[model samples]
Target: MRSRPVLVYDGDCAFCSSCVAFVERRIRPRCDTTPWQFADLAALGVVQQRAAYEVLWVTPDGRVRGGAQAVARLLLNAGGVWAVPGALLTLPPLRWIAHGLYRLVADHRDRMPGGTPACALPAARPPGPPGGS
Candidate 1:
């Protein structure tokens, strides 16, 4: 597999930028190489008209991961202290716990740096039944 991994982030996010920087500095040191691909959701097919999004990482195999799972997957690839925690977090009971923690962060990201309350929430569906027009 190619060593260089790709991380997709919100181009307009300051917190996301900081996280990218941390990945470039701290995370990169542990892994092979992370070639970050900053993308506007509109261009990446994650249209803002659909859902409020977070970070995504593309693995060498082209599998995509989002939120804390992405972070853990990246760390696991790095294969160090970062990997240890991620690996540990993936264990049976811990996996459930880890996903819970991830959900908390995803749910309240609006309060975090670079997160906008307006955009943090997913798009609401128009009121209607399951049937199409």
Candidate 2:
């Protein structure tokens, strides 16, 4: 139960759960995953809107990464064949390509029988203006 980086995932997604299970069992020194809803992203100083849409990796220092780079970072931390791809994805020229591929997969996750994947959380209703205006 050592404190480490946190992985935010969609708990309702079967694929996401499987991925988290992979990390929990395969990654030595095991990082923890928090359901996107329970982690208190804002309290953790994470930008909830940005992180909720895709995979996120929050390092111990509080920095965050999204898209394929996030997956690569986790892989890098996991220490194995993963490191090779992680190193490749982080390369500047290739980084955008990596993100693009990630976006494509994310865009159609539900079609894969992965679960009822849906885009975007519900819109937040802005609080009533100052003084109940």
Candidate 3:
């Protein structure tokens, strides 16, 4: 019976925290922001691995959106002028582009302003051979 959505992010990442601060001060989206480390992932319907991988937007109705889509949801919740770009980000070609851009930024977050080595996500492991090799 939660009323507002929850925005889950990496608290260990200074860059991510700074971005959240900016959103709170400027965009002011209608959601509760919590770092994944401090949030109850199971209750939010988010897995720990996925929460570690990207930002998440969990709605009151239990719909979960991640990464760029999460950003779009934030903007949409903010309403007013921000809603225009938010709606566009959910559309076709723009959605494709936004996904790519989000990945790029996520992959290099450690290099972004206010970021530290802690902001770097663990390197993705390649698929292993059969039999746990």
Worst lDDT 10-window in candidate 1: 29-38
Scored by TM-score, the top model is 3
- Alpha-carbon local distance difference test for all models: 0.58, 0.70, 0.92
lDDT of 3 by residue, 1-133 (tens): 7899999999999999999999999999999999999999999988877888899999999999999999999999999999999999999999999999998888789999999999999864222344556
Error of 1 at 44 (Å): 8.7
Q: Which order, best to worst by TM-score?
A: 3, 2, 1
Question: Model 1 has how many clashing residue pairs?
Answer: 0
Could you tell which candidate, 2 or 3, scores higher by lDDT?
A: 3
lDDT of 1 at 63: 64
Clashes (backbone N, CA, C under 3 Å), per candidate, total 0, 0, 0
Off by over 4 Å in 1: 1-3, 29-52, 114-119, 124-133
> What root-mean-square deviation over C-alphas does model 1 reach?
5.5
List the RMSD of every prediction in angstroms.
Answer: 5.5, 5.6, 3.1
Off by over 4 Å in 3: 125-133
Q: Write the per-residue lDDT of candidate 1 for residues 32-72, one digit (tens) a residue.
A: 32223334443334433222354566655656666666777
List ranges where model 2 is wrong by over 4 Å: 27-29, 117-133
- Estimated TM-score per prediction? 0.64, 0.76, 0.92
Question: Best candidate, lDDT-wise?
Answer: 3
